[model samples]
Target: MRITRVLGATALLFALAVPPAVADSAPSPSASGDDAAPTTAGTSFRTAAEVEQGQQATASASTGDYLYWSFPADAGQRPTVRATVKLPDAHAAQSWQIDVYDGLRRRQACQYGAQTRTAAQGAASVDLSCTLRTVRSWSEPWANDPLPGTYYVRLTALNVATADLGQPISASVRVGSKDVGGSAAVDGSLAEPLVPGIAVTSKSGEDDGDAAKSAVLAGLEPEDGWASGWWSDRWVWTAVGGVLAALAGVGGYALTRGSGRPGRVPPGA
Candidate 1:
């Protein structure tokens, strides 16, 4: 009778402990999520000269690849432009082209590059073992005169022999000169200064129409820095909860058996 009672108590304690375990395993709202739009830190022009030479330029290609420009956007002011390219899968891409564009999607500068690895070579490669590596990279400084105002960037990928798969991905940003006083756009209501880098504020009110028009003319996108998610995130929490439940069950079983050992004396008895 005593042994059975102890077992019952052990099971109850385990059941109680299981809830906490599951709670711990539960995924937080921030976890298991994809990156949203890029955050604006506001415009920061180091000197007056940079703001004066605002020229709108672009970099793009016929083939998909990477588009990059150096920061400090002033032609004579900054050095070392860096850029990122998100490629499709290796098997999905046979050839690549890169381009830079003005705000209007008109080509400004371009470079052609290709990356290919045999199925055997890629399968045997180090990068694709676990995570999918589907991105390319490029960077160049303002070796040429800096053109400011607004710029559009893009990368396109294609199948080797055919032009059928013309997947183009692009982003837009503003490049103000020092004359603009290193500008930033806000919702006009938030009145919050964006970070010190050139930015195109998405949030706009009637009062901000002028700023918005100027930004759009310069080729920057009106982004509130918010975009809907592609997939529901609730599943992530469900998965985390399931894991915790299992852990709690295991811990409870262990503790129950340990505490229910028959060797201990009962004072009430």
Candidate 2:
């Protein structure tokens, strides 16, 4: 009887201890658009600059026009970027595209859905979603790897089918990062920044010898920090250890208190 009671208590304790740890270890669900707010109204990449995670940028452009925005991401972080384009009702149908490029200006593959809208549709806006999993800063010299740096999102109007070349379409872009899990570098430092393509170009009429060298030096400087993976997370391991210790303690106690032990009898009986 005593052994059974002790075992039951141990089991209850274990049950109580595991849930919180699991909850802590699990990644939070992706956020909806409720918190997204437009932080920039600029239409060009250089003017828009870099946007922090969760902030949105609003821009107006026409067909064949490109709108650019940048987001800072760390290694091991999976960033989900979304863009919503509002079309003018005058057009019967339109298509829009979103492309993601790393800091080096190399285009990164993104899973996105093209938006096509018809005049009959009541909804004036269409959404485009792209997810880039696990940002890596390095690979073989010949390999193209998705690096952790400023990821640029380019929104373009593919087909407007309208006579008005100046028709304006509004776009809202948001970036969200979820820590999938990975260990940081041993030194806890970020990899080299990828140099922008135009960093070394001088004015049309002038030539500058230091442009290339300066750009290279700037790329070596760390722009963004590192993100830790699951292995580097100590709290999760500690929680796991606690659960194991509890289970082991219960097992050991059960073994010490033999299953065949006789039950205690009342003195009156």
Candidate 3:
């Protein structure tokens, strides 16, 4: 009976340990699932259609027209952009390409996949894809490394016959991302992703000059001198100015305060 009791106890402990093991082994879901599929694409970054990682964006555009789509990418994610263009009927051989650009409008190099493809004469469609490098949690501002931000996919026909320039063509694009796990994490993180849709509210009743960040972000940032044009210095200067102003007011009050105390009349009142 003792042996059976010990065996049951062992089984219970094993069951208790199984949850963390299962959770650790499960693959993380793609980060771009918050948005829906885009029915049409944008002509530029400002108007780019927004879509999630798995959602597909389709647009009815001309062969030579530029199609643009945007999606959010987080740190440690390796994003791959895939595009398909349906060639117009009875058109000559045409070439198409897919390009990815970061939020700064800088073009990103593809780590793999066919970024450009040419369709044969009378071909129905052409496929193009670009797999980008993993997004970094932090990096130097001068470096062109991929950081957490909004990414854009641009599709265009490289070469098309004059007759096919305005020909009706169908275009589709999808961005998919893979989580690279904690190994890709860095010591620092971006203050915010480079998505244009994000906005911070300004503090009310504060000076327009750097006062917006003087209290909050500046407090958290390092005070030691670093580089010029750094916003942190603005906070430091504002704080010093405020302290000096307060000291001046206090000194003026002390000097101007009458020597006689209130309600204390001297000699004959």
Query: Per-residue lDDT of 44-155 in model 1, one digit per residue for the tens?
Result: 1221111111222232232233434322222111211123333333333243333333322334432222222222211211111011111111112332322332333333
Per-residue C-alpha lDDT of model 3 across residues 48-130, encoded as one tens digit per residue: 88776666778899888888888777666788888888877788888999999987888999999999898999999998989
lDDT by residue (20-128, candidate 2, tens digit) is 3212121233344533444444455454445567666666676457777776776656677888878767655556677787777777776433323333333577788
Q: State which candidate, 2 or 3, has the greater lDDT.
A: 3
Off by over 4 Å in 3: 1-35, 197-269
Q: Between candidates 1 and 3, name the one with more favorable lDDT.
A: 3
Model 2 residue-pair collision total: 4
Clashing pairs in 2: 181-229, 182-229, 182-230, 183-229
Q: Which ten residues in a row have the lowest lDDT in candidate 1?
A: 127-136
Each prediction's whole-model lDDT (CA): 0.30, 0.59, 0.69
Top TM-score hit: 3
